[model samples]
Target: MWIKKFTIRGILVGLVCVFFLSPVCMAELPITSSFGWRVHPITGAWKFHSGLDLGYDYGTPIPAMFDGVVVQAGDFGDGYGNQVMLYHPAMDCYTRYAHMSGVIVDVGASVAQGEIIGYVGATGNATGPHLHLEWIVKGEDGGYVYADPIGLWM
Candidate 1:
């Protein structure tokens, strides 16, 4: 009797968690470049595409793909140039907008989904004006696992 009861209860709980706790993310805009291993445009060598590049004109506004707090926003001076990283607490995931010409949001700023946070630009190690997006899953060691945002879809 105990085993049967626990099995049924466990299944029910698992289903509920899947419905309420995990949410699938959708594409926020048109894609210019997809994610995955591809021949690099600049280097002409096979490399893992870390983010989704959205096509937009120079200075085109880029909206937040989901609700989150702005964790970092500024000229990274890294290869990404001006970027914005948003932390979604509910999902424990981060979304980075890279190669932007300018950022409107600041660190600790709360932004709703679809809110414009920055404009597209070819800053840093970029070829042209486009928003390079990256989705990062928070890891246990206080680090992050870069993921394909398209895989977040339901």
Candidate 2:
């Protein structure tokens, strides 16, 4: 009977540890910065703003959100202007940065988290100088879906 109780207690303790550690393992964004806020700039009115606007002076350096290979980097010409797409296999995610004044990384290049990848600016459809960052999870059908950037930061 004592051995049975000890085994049950061990299992309970293991379950508790797994429950607490799962989130930490899945949570992304190991770095913190003075980015992200709730404000609407596109509509010129207060709306549920998504993503972060890393406001720095024009030509301020922008960094990679994670270690990834630069899959696309150039003028997309569809209101994204100078854009870059990084593919992170570990996270199974892709990060896009739009409206860059200059793109520093080239296609097929590997970049580390927090490494400068470009410069923020008012390009394409932007009304002011800022970076429009987006995180996307690739769907099974080769389509990409948007994910909340704040969730990654948490």
Candidate 3:
């Protein structure tokens, strides 16, 4: 009887740890592809990937990693379909969410961290459904530089 009680307690503790310690609880975004140089899946040409790809099921709600205002939210009509761009004033940076099937926010809307702003999908020059996330910071030359979203944000 003592062994059974111990096992049950251990299982319960493990469940609590997993529930509270998981990414879902940690507010971490799910990433499918990383940023950097890689051979394109369709083009097969080596190039610098400007963003990290986070995937969810088709039409899954995408959360914002930080509080920001929506600057651009719509289709690029080419490489980035149904995208949402947010400008973070505190960070002095811009975050882009590309290749979305659907977007829920509009320009000038304020979004809180972990708030749903769009849905995941394979739009634009993508092979499957995923959120192409990009971090943009001001360059020394006044232009914007793209960075990997992995570890940098979530």
Candidate 4:
């Protein structure tokens, strides 16, 4: 399928960008939880966490990990709270910023790497103020998958 092909190309492009581009400029927020299957903090049930929970004071600015255009910006009541999703055409991947007190970017707006896109907050199934960051990639089956982001911004 076309989606599969595009995803494959995206993976290659992402590798090249990772090697040739400047280091990712992420905020130095403390990671409270990492990506993977784990016990849910709220429900106490086993679940797969799709992102990193970066703990910080309320209203702390959250930065974009790569140059991208905002594709979605708003609350959908999906347990992500006020969120921003960016599509990095160069890498053919998407990054998500969630649980924000505020979103500064609008849909379709271009954001540079490290630009402040939102603020941290305890929204949507959160216990405290933090930013839930997710790196999303398209799988070979043309479905989306979560990528561990510990190495990308650490």
Candidate No. with top lDDT:
4
Query: Taking the tens digit of each residue's C-alpha lDDT, what string does model 2 give over 1-154?
Result: 0000000111122212332233333233232222334344465654433334444567877877667999999997777789999998886878788889999999999988778899988888676787777667655455666555544422
Candidate 4 pairs with clashing backbones: none
lDDT sort, best first = 4, 1, 3, 2
lDDT of 4 by residue, 1-154 (tens): 1221111223223422432244334454367998888899999999888887877789977777778999999899899999999999986789889999999999989988778888888878899998887878767676777777665633
Q: What is the lDDT of residue 20 in candidate 4?
A: 26
* Candidate 1 lDDT by residue in tens digits, 1-154: 0000000112123212332244323444457787777898888999778887877789987787677999999986778999999998977877899999999998999998778898899998889998897877755455666666554443
In model 2, the clashing pairs are none
Please give, for residues 10-109, the per-residue lDDT of candidate 3 as tens digits: 2123212332244342144466666787898879999777887766679877777578999999986768888999998986878888898889998999
**lDDT score, candidate 2, position 142:** 57
Which segments of candidate 1 are over 4 A away from where they belong?
1-29, 138-143
Best by TM-score: 4
TM-scores of all candidate predictions against the true structure: 0.72, 0.64, 0.75, 0.78
Candidate 2, superposed: residue stretches over 4 Å from native: 1-51, 138-143
Flag regions of model 4 displaced more than 4 Å: 1-29
Residue 137: error of model 2 in Å? Answer: 1.4
